[model samples]
Target: MVLKKLVRYIINKYLKDYIEQLDYEKLKLDLKNGHVCLENLHLKPEALTDLSLPVTVATGCLEKFTLIIPWKNLYSMPTKVQIDGFYMLIVPKNGK
Candidate 1:
């Protein structure tokens, strides 16, 4: 259940109320590669309680750690928070 704990910890720390309706088929954490992959990820629109909450909440989470999207922004989100063990690389579908 370590994976579950890890996933929950990350979600709770970053996602907050959005977790209730977050949909993803898999949570794959590769320790050796220092990456977390959330496959088939999407959010159910109806579950969102507040529209502005997501925007501000997102900034809050990003403030805490380095966010890598597209796998191309990897080198930019400040190396201080980009600790290999702390960041998550959210490689969006087809690199979109």
Candidate 2:
């Protein structure tokens, strides 16, 4: 239960703003393989708000995303991120 809470906290802290839709029920975590998989995520329009950009994301979708963490060599090895089928549409806030 503690581990699950930690994972949820991390996700919420790091990804909640950017991810508009995330089905926690479908989240997959393979501890032995050190792999975390997320699929069919929709990005929020405010994803770029911190960037202070003039454009907005009209639509965004991530088909799949994978994070590979090396637990054994967590300090020595760099984490890897794999993103597939990421689509985004950006338009000017003024509709230009």
Could you tell me the TM-score of candidate 1? 0.36
Regions of model 2 farther than 4 Å from truth:
none
Looking at model 1, residue 91 earns an lDDT score of 24
Displacement of residue 64 (Cα, Å) in model 1 is 21
TM-score of each: 0.36, 0.90
Number of clashing residue pairs in every model?
0, 0
Top of the candidates by lDDT: 2
Q: How accurate is candidate 2 locally (lDDT)?
A: 0.85
lDDT agreement with native, every candidate: 0.39, 0.85
Looking at model 2, residue 59 earns an lDDT score of 95
lDDT of 2 by residue, 1-96 (tens): 675566667777889999976677877888678888889999999898899999999999999988788989999999888899999999888744
lDDT of 2 at 53: 91
